[model samples]
Target: MLLYTAMPLELVLDGIDRKYNFKEIDVDGIKLIIEPIDINHGKIVRLISTNPQDYLNSELSPGKIIEFKM
Candidate 1:
């Protein structure tokens, strides 16, 4: 996607200064997308696991806070 404009790059791009803190982690062989809430905890963003069983676990659903180690 290309957008040609006379505006400055900073002005043309929106929210470029915002920080994105998304992280991926593999917990017990299941993959997940997490947004950190603290040093040791993060809120679940989504399951990136290929196994269907990982999605079936209600505890792994989005918005659930889970503790993780770096």
Candidate 2:
């Protein structure tokens, strides 16, 4: 298991439906769900794994940076 840390980039979705609020991304072949907690502060994100075992084995502590690519 590996831990990733970095400053998370805020994604501004334009012309997107509110119903589709969550963002999905693939990291190292692992599918993760990025749920926005507070848009105003741009801090405190919830990273959810599709597999529960992966989530339990992995640790995403505070002060870790989150990076994204295009």
Candidate 3:
């Protein structure tokens, strides 16, 4: 993990900002990361759940489109 260089830290860490906007929302106790496609819909970026059974839901799969308010 050593960066053996004389370049400034800012220069070396450039372009770290995310271009796509991802929002975290909790629906029915399951947390999800969503990438908005429109005002009321988004594509599921990831699902955060502790239960292994929660991950089996097809609708919660990444890349699936879902509706959301706000």
lDDT by residue for model 1 (9-47), tens:
888788988898999988888888999998989999988
Displacement of the residue 29 alpha carbon in candidate 2, Å: 0.8
Candidate 2 residue pairs that clash: 5-65, 6-64, 6-65, 6-66, 7-65
What TM-score number comes out for model 3?
0.71
**Model 2 lDDT tens row, 6-55:** 74433333445556455665566666555544543221135555666665
**Model 3: how far residue 14 lies from native, Å:** 16
**Cα shift from native, residue 10, model 2 (Å):** 30
Comparing 2 and 3 by lDDT, which wins? Answer: 3
Q: Which portions of model 3 show Cα errors greater than 4 Å?
A: 1-18
Model 1, residue 19: distance off in Å is 2.7
Instruction: Extract clashing residue pairs from model 3.
Output: none
Candidate 3 local lDDT, 7-45, one digit each (tens): 999998888884978999998999999999999999999
Ranking by lDDT: 3, 1, 2
Candidate 1 segments exceeding 4 Å error: 1-17
Location of the lowest summed lDDT over 10 successive residues in candidate 1: 46-55
Per-residue error for 65 in candidate 1, Å, reads 0.3
